[model samples]
Target: MTLDDKKRVLREMVLHRRFEERCYQAYIERKIGGFLHLYPGQEACCNGVMEAARPGHDYVITGYRDHVHAIKCGTDPKVVMAELYGKETGCSKGRGGSMHVFDVAHRFMGGYALVGGPFPLAAGIAKGIQLKGGDEISICFLGDAANNQGVFHETLNMAKVWNLPVLFVCENNQYGIGTAIHRSTAVLDQYKRTCAYDIESAQCDGQDIDTVYEHAKTAVDFVRSGKGPYFLELMTYRYRGHSMSDSRGYRSREEEDEWKQRDPINILRDKLIAAGELSMADFTAIEKATDDYIENEVMKFAEESPEPNVADLEKYVLA
Candidate 1:
């Protein structure tokens, strides 16, 4: 990444980290409701991929833990918060909540909740692009656990057989719900699993923003070249529980702390600061700006976006 790009990625990673931090704080304060999943540790997977692709042209669909992707995809933070609050001005008009943020403008299909649901949906999106003679690419983001499902192999077989333009991103965060990857899979090389379909694949240090961008760029380009789907297994970890009410008895605090040491935001921040790309004052200013922006959005959503009139219920529903 260039110096300018590095600075931008650092700012983006911080925004995601802080945005998620604030979301968790809101959940604690009861200002935000519902099952809020924080993306504090997986910032690179969302932000790095966003930085690599054109938001309007490329499509990205993922499982729940979606707020970071919404932010990265240009959805207003206030609307996301409003959705969590079940307010009308939300991205899904207060219906989808935290799990289904769909933004057509950015080509973010949705935040599906079913473990491996988005796999085939993303394939369909890529097929649509191919039919329309467009160069757009679709990316399906799923956890390592989803890789075990029959849908994963089915999607891979069909996509490669048809030469669909898509990227299957496996965020092998080392855990799925509560089970470790090693305990779940006999074959731990998640990238090598792509060989079953003869697709190109690579593994990256998902904790490093630059490494992610570079590797994703290569994989995405390969897929876009009509070479078929590319798979990337990003070795990452989540700093928070799976959801709002997770007991978290499955992992150790020491494990979380060790991953925190390798936090993508911190790594990018340190690099930018050490390389004279950014200063502490600049970093602080960026943080303050992002916080203020989010606060302003929240207030705007609260004050300006009206609630859905009860009389209008069933209006959009099919008979």
Candidate 2:
């Protein structure tokens, strides 16, 4: 990667890391309400693939670990933060909160609450594009647990049969709410599950951006080149618990530390430095700038944004 490319990737990853850290702090401080999930460790997984996506053409739908997707897809952090704060300026008009950030303009579809709910929605969008004769594609993100949902299998069959252009990405972070994939999932190798339908598939280290980006180029190129659909299982680990409430006692500290040692952000940081593409001073500036951007720009915007009016509580609702 060129210096600019490396910087761009790190910037996006840093934005996610900083933004999520602040969001978690906000949640704990009672500044933001509802269940909060942090996307700290899964940065490279979303950043890598999104780098290959075209915002106006391609689309994305994902489960609740969605803040990174929305951010990477060009959603304004200000509005996204506002959404989490339940303010009117929020992307979902203060209704979607942390789990449901949707912005139609950017083609980042709903941040669905259900585990496997987004699978069909992604397929439907891909089908719509195909029917319209538009050459666009949709990507779906899910945790390993979501693979157990029936909708996953159903979408796989439908997508493969109809040749829908959708990429199913399983962000397997090892644990699904404290249950290890081995204990919960019968087919531990999730990508191989797609063999039944003959859809193209792959698995990669989610913590390595280069690995993911390289794999995404091939997978995305295949799907974009009119291959039915693709499935990729990202072997990753989430440093934080499933939610803010999780005590995380189900896993050992040694295990968490092991994964943490391979933190995606640091991996890229060291790579760029060793390649002579980045300097320590440049990285320090990035760190300061990231903190400043979130504190002064996003956090301030969400903090100062107006809350939704009680009178409008019945407005966006459909009875």
Candidate 3:
């Protein structure tokens, strides 16, 4: 990546971090309601991978920890914040809230509420691309725990059999909603599990944006080359609990502190600073700009946007 790309990624990660922090405050203040899942420590996983692919051109889907991914895939931050606020101007038109941010115009399929739900959905999208003879590939971002679902196995099998153009990215954050992954999963290494499906797979450090981007680029290329599916396991750790309601009692303070030392945002920022490619003043300016944008633009849009009208309650309903 060029110096400019690195600087752009650093600013994006910082903005995502601050945005989620504000969401935490709003959730606590009862201003935003729902099963809020904040993405703080895993910014690199999404940004790096999406940076490797064409954001608005490629199809992107993931589980509920999705605001950052949507923003990276061309969804405006203001609309994302408005979605959390359940405002009419939200990306999902105020219906989906934090869990289901859908922006098809950007080819960001959605952030599904169901665990492992995106597995088949991604495959289906890839199949459509295959039939249409388009060069687009579907990217699915999921957690370590979602791999346990039967759909995980089923989707991989179908993707391989049909030679679907899809990239399965597992954000292994070490735990699943208070349950440690080791306690629930039989196969510890998620990348190894892909071998059974005969799909190309790799694992890498999710804390480093550069590393994630490098490996993700290779994986994305392989998938786009029409060589079937590729699986990437990013060994990451989330700083917050599974959701706002989680107390994180199952995790230790020592573990938390250890992971914080390798925070994704800090990793890239320090690398840039160490290389003299970025200065403290430059970083400070970036922080200030992001803070002001969120405050004066995103938050303001969400806070002032109108709630979904009662008359349109059945507007988007399928039934």
Best by TM-score: 3
Which residue runs of candidate 1 sit more than 4 Å off their true CA positions? 299-304
RMSD of each: 1.6, 1.1, 0.9
What clash pairs does model 2 have? none
Poorly placed runs, candidate 2 (over 4 Å) = none
lDDT value, candidate 2, whole model = 0.89
Q: Write the per-residue lDDT of candidate 2 for residues 40-115, one digit (tens) a residue.
A: 9999888888776675468899988888899888899999999999999999999899999998889899788888
**What residue pairs clash in candidate 3, if any at all?**
none
Q: Which ten residues in a row have the lowest lDDT in candidate 2?
A: 48-57
Q: Write the per-residue lDDT of candidate 1 for residues 1-319, one digit (tens) a residue.
A: 6788788778777777777887788789887777887787888887776677777678989999887787777877777777777677888887788888878787778899988989999999999989998988999888888988889899999999999999988888888888888999978989998898998899988999888898888987898888888898888999888888887899899999999999888788888888887888998999998888767766456546777778877676776
Q: Which lDDT tens digits does candidate 3 get at residues 225-308?
A: 999999999999999999999999998999999999999998999999999998899989999999999999999999999999
Instruction: Write down the TM-score of every candidate.
Output: 0.95, 0.98, 0.99
Question: What TM-score should be assigned to candidate 1?
Answer: 0.95
Best by lDDT: 3
When summed lDDT is taken over every stretch of 10 residues in candidate 1, the lowest stretch is 294-303
Candidate 3 off by > 4 Å? none
> If both were scored by lDDT, which would come out higher, candidate 1 or candidate 2?
2
